[model samples]
Target: MGGALVVYESMFGNTRAVAEAVATGMARVAPGDAVDVIEVGTAPALAAVDADLLVIGAPTHAFGLSRPTTRSDAAARTGTGVLSTTIGVREWLEHAGAPAALPADGATPARRGLPAAVFDTRVLRRNLPGHAADAIARRLRQLGLSLVTEPATFTVDGYTGPLLPGELDRARAWGEYLATLLRALPLLPEDAGATGARGRTETPGTGRSAPRTGRPASGTGPSAPGSPR
Candidate 1:
């Protein structure tokens, strides 16, 4: 295989560790494929650059996705304002000028149409919030990426989680599986190198509308769409 990328956002470092395990699994299964793991905040904005697969993961926050920082209307225990919608932390950042902030990064490598998957570590107060995973998978699929397991979930005891004992193994298993699957796909068309169309589609997690014509309106603030498949 040519290459693959794993982009992740983690709070307690468990998720980052899990990402490393996942990458190792990928390398194990696909000996020649290139795998790069980076924190979401530091990862160059990745869009249309194509890879054989991409796996996105994070921690669950208040029935949604987590972020390193937040702007909730009301203060929360995490120190960021709570975002009370279907939107997640990354989407919020997207609407919060993620593009202009990337003055130094060239177009990110695309992983369109590959076998993409998503996961999250959530406090087990409830079964596990699914939207965070769906939100990530939906973003990948909007680029026509294939999905594995409608995204998956990893668990822990409280809001700030260590993801139980074996979740990192699970993540690695997922990465290995995805890498094996990606071997079947062809290289991207030469033209699919730039960022894929930056518009929203009917995300499965929330039928919440994508930004009108690929752009968020002023003050709308990026939020995850409410629950859906």
Candidate 2:
């Protein structure tokens, strides 16, 4: 809860900008908190995410996560450097393993249920059927990560464009809210360096889901092949 890692995939830099803004917001609330912002291309798999809080963002491609074809189309259209088409948040989560460290009994560490949140950049005008953010959130939950917020979106002007006005500010605000939420929650015994993995079961209500408000780019964002599990 004192450390946060933000991983994002961006072709036009919109999503990366949002990720920085969110990190800035988190810093405002917890000045001493550790925060790492990583781009998907250079980012390690999700299992390697070693923070108490994990925040992920990507451009909403087709309707969900970006696939090989969409990523290629984006790089070609933008003429900007793109990461490997085979790798993104979706692919990272797909093969993510269990936590690096566990309790002596080999039980899932109480901290294994790390708090997580997801966001995406999308076109404001075109309404998409699915969301990369939602897909990422669901995958994190499947990995036993706690959901600190629902899928959130920041708006972009068009396919490859400037972010909508004030979206960065909103993202900062969201980060601050996430920090406050993390602070108010009690840490698990193991999380506090206790001798064993002992704590109450963390159910859904323990984490707060943020409300939906905006969209991102239309064609330039990530689109999952299907709905989130």
Candidate 3:
């Protein structure tokens, strides 16, 4: 069996809602698998991640991933409900050191490069540019993790928003789609080699299997409205 961990950062809870919805969708499809949803502020170090899949989500700020300055600005707003004040996904990925090495006795396997997916929440607007998901996908690749799907976006009414109608349903559907892809791939054995095989997982959104050792999937851009806070 495989498990998934969803880590997210939110300002006014829109992204958190989407993250939970995605987790719910995955649970619905893979009822026997372990699915966890947690705020990025409380997430364990990347080296401590112990799952087959990693899903990350955040709100877009300044047309990209949020920074300490941007997060501060968001908190300064009059009526905002900031959820993460200290750390954001940007800092989390930046601080992810190399995976731990195998023990001298070689009994336990070193951490494998887990398959990953990313999503973001931003405001709905005509021709608005930029996605935190895009930046997130880049960082995941830089960390040597392959993407199981393109970056996803869920729309919000504004910077601080009640999510637009049916966005949660759409998020759930995307999550279900991701779980199906995870089900198609074979899980690594307890004693599998450290250099695990690639191309074992399906391409994002396509049912076809990826080529072995092929380049990680790249995002085409944001597919829907998302958060701007």
Candidate 4:
């Protein structure tokens, strides 16, 4: 059986709930697969992440990925009930190191090219603009990991949210889809750069390197959450 590691950061626990649902969904489709879910603060060291797939999730803050400062703000918010430590996902990624690059000489290497996927929890609003999903995707791509799919966004009612109705189901479905897609991806070390493989045709750590302000695009303004990326 293959293994998956799901690491997530949550302030009001909305994102954490989505992470659990996503893991459950993956388990349903890949019954033989082992899934480990950990909060960012308690996450095992990145060097020890030997899972076949790495799935990450975070809540959108300040129209993009939450910085330490933003996380501090979240913790300070009234009624947040944030019992966990203050670490956020951005800090974790900075220390996670780039995913192993495709091995040279067509030989299998320890920690061969890793495949990753990302998702974000956002407030459900009609016109909310920026998102953490794109930021998260860029970071993974910058790390040289194969992205099985574009980043996925799940919605919440508000910042400290009960997820929107059926959003949990949608997240689960996305996870199952990810499991299926990963199962179909070419896994041989030599196949990393092949056409059918994801993200390898491009240079390492250069997937869709779009210039970003870490803010929403022009004419866009923050509204609610889960803005399309």
Candidate 5:
């Protein structure tokens, strides 16, 4: 009966579309479970997060996550079409404080470090390097959130793109996969580490390695294209 929250940063709305699709897929798989999607600008603080699972998405800028300067550049390119200009995922994570300590009364806490997944939208080009998803995964790990899956990438036709065909479908499928995985795993204690109290690996069922650093292990891609808007 756990819920999920999907938080995203978008320049031209492609990432927002993917975030919604992911939530849609999760809802379809677990209709009775709560699934919420939110823009990163308005996302709750880390200490305020109340979900059993967390999903983050953003656009790839330069070679990684967007900085204020990059976001400003994107805003200039779009005029008024940019979805978020003030704060991107990178800044949000940078300011994220650790979760509030558990209640001292031994009562169940509102939430604990969660199982998280990350995805990014990038140009659909072969052998292209850099993934915001990878960087996001690393930061979430540093915050002690266990990754349920490797970072994922969705491709746009270009820089401010309409996502390539099937990318939304792929995102939805990934969301469903994540929901399934969460449902299959046993819930752990609030203070458990990435490996869970039972010593099971972070990615149960899936054989993917939950490496702390390096490039994302799996993804879909496309070259820079038109904006979804």
Candidate 6:
């Protein structure tokens, strides 16, 4: 088994809690695996030679991956300088030109073939049209990470949530499951045969599954345990 890391970004406490749960799950299922959970910006050294599987978490923002509004986050940074950075996070990315060019990394090739997964926290759309979790999943696939497609949806009765009661437990389960996979990295059971495949376990909000910061978009229902992303 290889050492694993669970990295995440959360605005409100909901996504952070989910991240922890996922980390916990990884530890439980793969006791032999080393698991380190870190928040987004404070992520461990991804460039480390010892690093193996790379796990990520984020909220679905405005129908997409919630980023700092930078021009380009994952793609901007070069091996050692700003010229090679993914600067599209908080700034207007359009100026860089959607059809424009991205910085080329002379030190490392694009992370086009890494293993990755995405999880999201969101408010119910009353329909599937606003399902941002799926969007997060899709983005991860585009980045060339092997898709585990374990995207999840968190319940938000209204904006700031009470989490509909059993949210924490559900979060814990997610963590345990992730630990299981990380422990057996590069060789765990495929999503085709287990927990997430055909309703083997009870999830937080929706079955098809589905964080945080500066008060995300508001929800319309009852109060949730935390805020909606």
Give the alpha carbon lDDT tens digit for every residue of 1-229 in model 4: 3788998988888888888888997899799989888998898755556777888888989888888787778778846457346677887777766555334232432143466777787775644567786677776666556555556667677677888777777677766765765565554232221222222111134222111111122213221112222
Ranking by lDDT: 3, 5, 2, 4, 1, 6
TM-score of 1: 0.61
Considering TM-score, which of the candidate structures 2 and 3 is the better prediction for this target?
3
Q: The CA-based lDDT of model 5 is what?
A: 0.69
lDDT of 4 at 216: 20
TM-score of 3: 0.76
Worst 10 residues of 2 by lDDT: 193-202
Sorted by TM-score (best first), the order is 5, 3, 2, 4, 1, 6
Cα RMSD, each candidate:
11.5, 10.9, 8.7, 10.0, 9.0, 11.9
Estimate, for each residue in 61-126, the C-alpha lDDT of model 6 and write its tens digit: 555555554213322332332221231111221232322122223133223334444555555455
Please name the candidate that would achieve the greatest TM-score relative to the true structure.
5
Q: lDDT of all predictions, in order shown?
A: 0.51, 0.65, 0.70, 0.64, 0.69, 0.44
Q: Candidate 3, residues 95-212: lDDT per residue as tens digits? A: 8754333123323321444677888887776556777887887777666665665567777887888787887887887777678766644442221211232213333553322211
Instruction: State the displacement of the C-alpha of residue 86, model 5, in Å, after optimal TM-score superposition.
Output: 1.7
Q: Write candidate 2's Cα lDDT for 40-135 as tens digits.
A: 877765655667778889988998888878888888886557544457777777667544442233243234567677788777653246667878
For candidate 3, give the lDDT of residue 205: 51
What is candidate 1's lDDT per residue for 1-229, written digit by digit as tens? 5677677776556567767887997899878778988676555445543565666777655556654444242225455432232434376336424333322233444433345656665654433334466566555545455553335556555554556666666666656655654553343232121122222233244322221111112212221122112
Clashes of each: 16, 16, 6, 1, 13, 39
Q: Which residue runs of candidate 2 sit more than 4 Å off their true CA positions?
A: 83-86, 97-111, 187-229
Model 1: how far residue 36 lies from native, Å:
0.6
